[model samples]
Target chain A: MEDDYYSIESILAENQKIQCTFKIDVPDMGHLDGGNERDIKALSKVQVPLWMAYILIYSDYADFTIPPPFSARVRSALNAEARSVRLSNLVGQAGLWYGFGRMIMRLLNDDVAKEMSDVLVKTFRDRLPEVIDQAQHFASVHASSADSGVGGDNATMLFREGLDGTERELFALAQDSTRRTKRWYETSERGRRS
Target chain B: MALPTPLRASVTPAELELIASEQLVEIVPLVAMERTAFISGAYGPLRPPTKCKVPIWMATNLKLKKKCRVVPPDWLNVEFLEGRLTQETSEAGFSEMPFRFAEVAKVLLDVAPDDFPNPDKIRSLLKDIREARQAKSREGLSKLDHSELSLPNLCSMEINEIRPFFIRAMGVLTDLVKEAQPQQDAP
Candidate 1:
């Protein structure tokens, strides 16, 4: 639980940094960042909030470097061992991660984003059966143990029961992902503000 | 004002309202309105004596306008809810109910309690169902402290009912995690 909390917090911090991080070619924005240099070729990476990033991305004035967990590393991880990793954080903060990734994918048409989306879908579908099996088995064993007195044949399963809500939490996260995905298509027909 | 409840899952009256909006309500129209539209798609041509499938909102509006008499959902009856409560207790499960049961019941009972022979019976049954479910959730919560590694399958309503208990359990679990963290970090 502590590890999850720490990892989630660290992930959140990284996301926050990314939200305020980007590379823009605009000159007016540099003056706001307290830089004295007013040269035309002084283009450098700057950290700005996502709201500003959207305008830059939309105007085709800036290039968004794909942040961590949405990178090729995660794609390789999915191809390797997706289960050991906490995939819920990928769709972090009520679909912020997925929504942003999707928006970036659409805006840039980056193949990396495309691959990430494919791997996410595949990984989620693959993980579903195992998660359901574990959840149901854990639930039944817990129920039976409660019914019985001391111990049961499924004593081995009891160790997995108190899993800090990984399965159910992921279940909810997956549902949120589905909903966000639908909204993406529904509202994407509009010019990307919805 | 009641305290807002903490929940593990996102379930609320809003979901019930979503279900309620799709429910088939029986309405007998007094004023003939030909296929009217009201946000949630087109519905109408409400004719009297010929019962039609109207959404709950349309039925409510018709009832409010003194146009059509809204035949409350069949499950809204006192006897039915009492049966549901019994079933909920005996089977440790619930039968499918009309969405927004509590909200709709309160609306109907508040507006036209006289339609039923004993309105208080229905209210009491709803109260009992609520109380019993809350109590059942509390039972699961009470045992949470005894075992650190137990996961309980709580329905949405039960989760809402056990909000405070859930917070307490979370606090305990957080402390436990904190206690375990240092040892693991000490390599």
Candidate 2:
């Protein structure tokens, strides 16, 4: 867990250096309820670092050469699609990473963002099992409540369960988010060819 | 490319069944129709007959066969498989299909009178099916331990293979919607 934490922090540091060169004010974090604001803020702040990492990683996948005319045309079409889809504003270097993370969390489960916060904290503390156990317990409790058909305060319980160990949730979120981002990038590439 | 003539009459369930059957035959292979199935309403049941089955093995087999390399399981229906040969399967996966359909549907639904139920529901249902397929895929992937050397590449290969089928499915769906469209001048 300590190693994981160190790696994550290092990634964050590298990302900050790469991405924050052209800094923009972080957008409004939006409405967070049920003690979720804390977690949201934490996740939001990490976007800066994540974007930095993305630039480095994406470069590994493809060279940053100036796109040819076809690619430029495709990029323009994608930009139009993004605008129509409301993705233009949602995507920037950092904003894109953050949006990707949020979309992953939403797809996995609504409470994922909060859970990731817990995972990051646990990773820092080097208590992987404890985090896992807590998450398991929370999942168990929520399962029971759901089975009983009692909808009582399950949101917090689920959040607690999700947040229980290490940065598993964050890692999952990042993986899915990256996948989606790649899809968008590919779509633009295709638009250029078409 | 020329669009098909607009379907003037409301499709009877019987017509829908026939269309579904024709679609199945055109898209998927000639497997015997199973006992339990759902036929589309566009082609009436008496028409050709579109048979719907859980095709679980077919989905799984596609990954192993290497015919498809990148599509997810939900997109691996018989109809989708047919479309992949001509279309670039990677670009036409189930995910992209619904996204495109939804975009078109939104426009149609918006201009459509208030009485009409949104076509978005169909897109949603398609997405649900895709997710269910993904869940099955996750279960299958779990059986293969992460420690294996070839696991990562194998998983990606499977996904790539499945992508074409999804693209084919999207093409079929687009065809269906276009076929069902009212004439441009009609009310």
Off by over 4 Å in 1: A1-194, B1-22, B89-99, B114-117, B143-158, B163-168, B171-187
Residues A1-194 of candidate 1 have per-residue lDDT tens digits of 12244445323332433332334445444564457756323346655544456666665565667667577777787678655455446554333333344334443443554554565445444444444334334443443455553343463244223222333454334333333322322231211111
Task: Please give the DockQ score of every candidate, comma-separated.
Answer: 0.02, 0.02
TM-score of 2: 0.21
Candidate No. with top lDDT? 1
| lDDT of each candidate versus the true structure | 0.49, 0.29
Q: What overall lDDT, based on C-alpha atoms, would model 2 receive against the true structure?
A: 0.29
List clashing residue pairs in candidate 1.
B35-B45
Give, for candidate 2 chain B, the lowest lDDT window spanning 10 residues.
Answer: B4-13
Chain A TM per prediction: 0.52, 0.21
Determine the C-alpha RMSD for candidate 1 after optimal superposition of all C-alphas. 18.6
Among these predicted structures, which one has the highest DockQ?
A: 1
Which parts of model 2 are misplaced by more than 4 Å?
A2-153, A160-162, A168-175, A178-191, B1-133, B140-146, B149-187
Error of 1 at B123 (Å): 1.7
